[model samples]
Each structure stands twice: as C-alpha cells, then as structure tokens.
Target: MEHHAPTTEFLGMTFNLSNVLMITIASAIVFILAVVTTRSLAMRPTGLQNFIEWVMDFVKGLIGSTMDWKTGGRFLFLGMTILMYIFVSNMLGLPFAIAIDSELWWKSPTADPTITLTLATMVVVLTHYYGIKMKGAKEYGRGFVSPLKFLFPFKIIEEFSNTLTLGLRLYGNIYAGEILLGLLAGLGGAGIAGALGAFLPMLVWQGFSIFVGTIQAFIFTMLTMVYIAHKVADDH
Candidate 1:
C-alpha cells in the first residue's frame, strides 16, 4: 500500500503538521517552565530557585570566561534564554519507550530551516542594534570602513555570511538527523527482515543524532554570545 503525505495549513501557508505541533508544544513548555521557575524568589534558594540559580551561574560562567563580567552580565539573559530554548527544542524529539507508530512528531523546530533562520536573523539584528547603541552611529558606520575603507564590501559580506552560517549549521544537522531517522523507519516498516537490517544502524544514528543536537544547541548559543560580545566589547 502506498501512503500519502500529510500537509498542514495555517494562514494560507503550508507546513508539516508534525513539525508545527512539535515546535508549538516545545515553545509552550519553555514559556511555562520559565514562568514557574521565576514566579517566586527565595532568600535562601531551594527547589526551582536553586535550579534557576544554577543555570544562571552556568551561563554567567560561559560569558564571563569568554568576556569581561561587565559585558557578560549585560547580555547574560539573552544568552541564557537562547540556550534554554534551543536545548529544550532539540531534545523534545528524542525517541522514548513508546511504540514508534504511536509517535506523532519526529522532528525538532531547529530542524526546520525557517525556524532556525528566523532565530539567526533575530540574533544578527540584535547584534547590529547593540553595536549602534554601544558605538554610536558614527563609530558603527566606521566599522564597515575600518582598517581600509575599500574593505566595506567584504565587511558587509562577512556579516551576511555569519547569519547564514549560524542558521544553516543548525538546520543542516537537525534536518539530516530527521532524514536518517526516516530512512530507518522505512526499513523497519518492512517487517522482521527490515528490522534486522535497520535496528543496529538506527540505534547508532539515534545516539549520534542526540549528540549532534546537543552540540548544535551549544554552538548556536555560543555564537550568539560571541556576536553580542563582539558588538558590545570596547575593543571592536
């Protein structure tokens, strides 16, 4: 029997329903967790406060190590929020003990180029905003002409390339992972013979995909911090 693909439409735009739902659910979970974690502040930390504090410290350390405390503290919230959102979204698609057929969603939001590109665009725009805010319009404009005014085109190209790389790197990794899983599932659908052919490879790929997902999240977060730091740093 041949299977027809499913399509979802919203606002006249078509998207894979599974991908849309998974991203929506993940975003909701992140928002709820953020609300719950920050609703109460304790003088002596416990429970959610302790967990929140630990995550803050971890992000603080990452920025502090890469940059000065003053700059790091300034962008700490942005960095932490990006890291948490991506990390949770990446892990949301992990396979569980439930039967594979029962699983409705099989890909993470970061796997979608549209979602990742939107995030990358936001980061790039924020970098420009902070750059202008910190350096003033004159100095910020001078950055394009720095070292040699003739290099302005190259600088502009570099900025565009940074945003492209930030988005594509994440989308490529997660999309490839999803493709590999789909291939494995196709093989597994062929019954006992296919299960034998697919199981070991599926196991290895799943494990490696999880690893890649985690590393991609870290890379995205780190690049975001690096971009902000470059923008806000005193030394250009």
Candidate 2:
C-alpha cells in the first residue's frame, strides 16, 4: 500500500503518526471553527454562525429522534463532537495527499482503524457508564440477561460485535473511497489518455464520495445515540 500509517515510538510504546496528526488537525479545525462561529451572538446569524447554528439544530433533532430529550440531551456534546470531527476529517482527504514509503501525511483519520476503534470504544464505554449511572449496577447487569437468563451470553457477545461493526463500518467505507481516489490519481498521472480516461470517473466518484462521507458520519452519530438509548432507557 502506497498509503501506510507511519509509526513512531514513545515511552516504550509505538503509535501511528499519520493517524495522530490527522486526528489532531481535524480536532483543532473543529474547535477553531466552533469558537469563531460563536464568538459573538447576533440578532440574526450570518455566514459561519448561521451554518453552525443550523448544524446544531440538525444534530439536536437527530438526538431527539433517537431518544427522549430528557435522556439524550446529555449527549448533545458528544454527538456534536463526533459528527463535526468525522465530517471534517472525511473531507480533509478529498484534496491532495502526500504519502512516502510507510508514512502517510494526509488522509481521513477515520480511514485508520486505531482512530475509528478508539472512537467506537469511547462511545461504548460512555453508554455503559451512563447505563450504570441511570440505573443501578445490578439493574444494568441484569439487562444483559433481560427476558431470559439464557440470552446473557449472546448479549455479552453483542457488545463486542457492536464495537467491531461500528468502527469497521466507517473505516471500511472511507478507506475504500480513498483507495479508489488514489487509483484514479495514479491513472491520471500516466499521460493525456490517462487524464481523459480518469476525468469523468473521478468527477463522478468525488461527488459520490462526499455524499458517502456525509452519510457515514450521520450513521455513526445516530448509532451512538441508539447504543446509549438501549443501555440507559428505563425500559431496558
């Protein structure tokens, strides 16, 4: 693979540098945008502020759709953070990328398993934490065996499955899209014939990829809320 995650050692451990950089950059961009957008309040929003306020309302609606506002409102920050970060990270790779040897300096952070899995783990952990907080430990534990004790093992397995699927789903889609874009770029590098061949296809896929990225981010956000609802709902 031309685009491989760069590794570096730290404190007797190793980490993927490319993934780390992308994550950090994406986070900083989102943070800066948030601050800039809301720096001042106006009677009528304009430009960045208008767009950001719209995003907040859209995200809040998504949260409300999944669970009651009383319970889901607590995760508004988490939901918003994940949605904005993922969307921005996904778009980051749509431009140019630089990859040398086993080091990639540009790409979507979610394209790396480490980043996506860590995110999925955080969401899962929070769901369990909120579950225990909302309902007693005993009650939350009993949820695994709800309706029937025989289902306890399956319920336990579901937790692991959810974690795997949640991360892999985003990683798979974004990584595949990036791979295709990379191949298209390679083709265009050949000559005039190559450019002609790749042009229309590249244009089509680029537009579709953006749509795919947006949908994947939304799906991930929705699933986060759903997982939380399943764990923390009173009926659970």
Give a tens-digit lDDT track for model 1, residues 1-236: 22222467789998766667777877788888888988898799879988888888988877876679976787888887887888778776556212234444545778778889989999999989988997788878887887798999999998899999999999898877876787787788889999999999999988998898888888998888888777767665
lDDT at 232 for candidate 1?
Answer: 68
lDDT (Cα, tens digit) per residue for candidate 2, span 1-236: 55566889999988888877888999999999899998987988888889889988988999888788999898998898899999998888877678877478899998888788989999999999999999889989999988999999999899999999999999998988999998998998889999999999999889998999999999999999999999988774
Per-model CA lDDT versus the true structure = 0.80, 0.89
Clashing residue pairs in all predictions, respectively, total 0, 0
By TM-score, how accurate is candidate 2? 0.95
Question: Per-residue lDDT for 214 in model 1?
Answer: 80
How does each model score on TM-score? 0.83, 0.95
| True-structure Cα RMSD, model 1 | 3.6
Show the lowest summed lDDT stretch of 10 residues, model 2.
94-103
Ten-residue region with minimum lDDT total, candidate 1: 96-105
